[model samples]
Target: MKIVQSTWVRYHHIDLARELHEMGHLERIFTSLPWWKADKESREQHVPRGLITCNFLMEGVRRMGGKLPFYSKGTDAKLAVIHTKNYSKWIARNLPDCDAYIGISGSGLHAGKVAKSRGAGYIMDRGSSQIRHADRILREEHLKWNLPWNPVHPWLIENEEAEANEASLITVPSHFVKQTFIHQGTAPEKIRVVPYGVSLQEFHPVQTPPDNCFRLVFVGQFSLRKGVPYLLEAFKAFNHPNKELVVVGNVSDEIRPLINSIGTEHVKFVGIVPRAEVKRYLSTAHALVLPSIEEGLALVQAQAMACGCPVIATPNTGSETLFSNEKEGLIVEARNPKALAAAFTRIADDLDLRNEMSMACLERVKMLGGWRRYAEGMVAVAREAKALVLSTQ
Candidate 1:
């Protein structure tokens, strides 16, 4: 099968593209970023047949702060909507003849329509919870925190809905994401749940924890959406003398007040480390906590598991798909500081339990089979989507 994939930004689409290339199915990839900007290893290994850069002019505009019009704080979201529309239009106009066209959600509506018209299967790849669900939950969260809520732009919403309606299949990263779409009235058969994978090559258990303190790590943006306030409260409540919280992401301005109010004596905010450095922190930490109230399947959970760090995550993070509660790690209720605290205390108090859980993390990750399996699953989905399109004819 000849497959073409397109995305405005290189999230995991490049990984998917490489997988398809390995399977001898990828015909091309349309991305906003140039090939030189992609990972050096991926570019060397799988030089895709057709790599179309769609953001040359837009990158220049971005460098000139065109997206930031008047130094506005929230203008990027609006600009992102415009960019998605532009990408959709570009793909629609330049779509290649292929057996299947897989495009990221939000930026695929027009392209999907064009692909369907050309008798090719169109697959919508969603990397997070359904947009409607995300908007509602995030808006409620912002309101609870007494902050201004910026729900997703209407243009982006319309585009996502149109893509979902037009695509032959919608692929999501987790069961949580799939349920969100079903809850929002999408047909169960229309969504495919293919959990993401981590690179064991880059993230292996290489470090031994220090004897003095038990360290907990949290990666990703420190924001309300990640349940940062709840994590702070839980960490504050946990009464361990030799414990530390290592935050390995940028602290958003909105959440800084809460961080300051909570005090960061025991917390180290190591803002945004390189991707290769993330595994180092994960390998040394006893546990990784992700108290996100909204997520697809967090790739960090898999990455942590691969590095022998047990995960403490909320159900909303789709961590249950990675490991069972109390098996590889603990699963707590989202937005519940008490539940999060209890889980933390359990791991901190019992050294043997932590060790056992860490071992289980490695075993569970082995079963998941990393990015190779993820690509194979996506290929199967593309094949199925193509078959569905053929049956209709």
Candidate 2:
């Protein structure tokens, strides 16, 4: 079976394509990432450069636009729509004959339609919750937190919805993402839940945590959607003399003031570290805290687990799919700082439990394997989509 793929960026598609190509299923994959970066990633994965396409000019423009002084969230939203539409059109123009087309949600609506018109299946790969569901909940969260909120642009939402409606199959990384689509009126049968994988080669148990200091690390973008405020409140309330909270990733402008207003004791902000550094942080920390409000499967949870660091996250992050609650990690309700604080206290006070969870994390990664599982699921979904198209014809 031949399949074509497109991704707006690297994300997990490189690994997915690597596995697919090895299985002799990938026709070729298109990406809007710059040529240099894309080539480097493909080389790292042992994927031949001949099996990939890169739209470096458009990617360069998008990158530079984001760095402009006047660029706001509003502009970012507008550019997202423009970029997706142009990229989709470009993909359609260069389309090749294949059994099916698999495209990232917002970036391939036009190409999906073109592929379908040519008697090929179109699969929409969504890595987040439904666009409408995400926008609504994030808006409410911003209002609740009293932060300046720029709502999701309607065109972007409309485009994503159109992609979902037109595709032969919708593929998501987690059941949480699939449920969001169902809640937003999409048929459950149209969606497939394929959890993401972590690179066991890249992340592993490096060393055990040092005694006498309880370290908690929060990775990913530091913003309201990630439940940073709740983490801050919980961290302050944990009340340990030698406790440390390492805040990684970029802090948004709106969250900066609120972070300043809250507890700053023993908190370290090391923004935008390298991938190697991220693994190091996950490996050394006592536990990884991800209080995100909405996401597909957080690969970090697995990465942390692979590093022998148990996770403390909410259900919305698809943590349940990673490890059993209270076995390998803790799960607390979202927007509940008190509960998070309590989880912190529980893990902090128990030494044997910590070691047990760490061991459980390593075993879970052993079972998860890596991106090979995700690639197998995608191939199965691709065949189903092809079958659906041929049966209807």
Best by TM-score: 2
In the order shown, what is each candidate's alpha-carbon RMSD?
Answer: 1.9, 1.4
- What's the lDDT for all of these models? 0.85, 0.89
Write the residue-wise lDDT of candidate 1 on 1-393 in tens digits.
898898766688877777778788888788777445654534554654345445545544555674455845357676677677787888788887898899998777888888877778899999988998999999999888888777788877877988898899999998889999999889999999998888888789878777899899999999998999899999999899888999998888887777788777799889999988999999989899999999988889999999999999998999877789998999999999999999999998899999999999899999998788998998899888888887887
Kindly provide the TM-score of model 1 when superposed on the true structure, using C-alpha atoms.
Answer: 0.95
Q: Which prediction has the highest lDDT against the true structure?
A: 2
Model 1, runs deviating above 4 Å: 39-45, 49-52, 59-69
Off by over 4 Å in 2: none
Model 2, 35: alpha-carbon shift in Å?
A: 1.2
TM-score of each: 0.95, 0.97
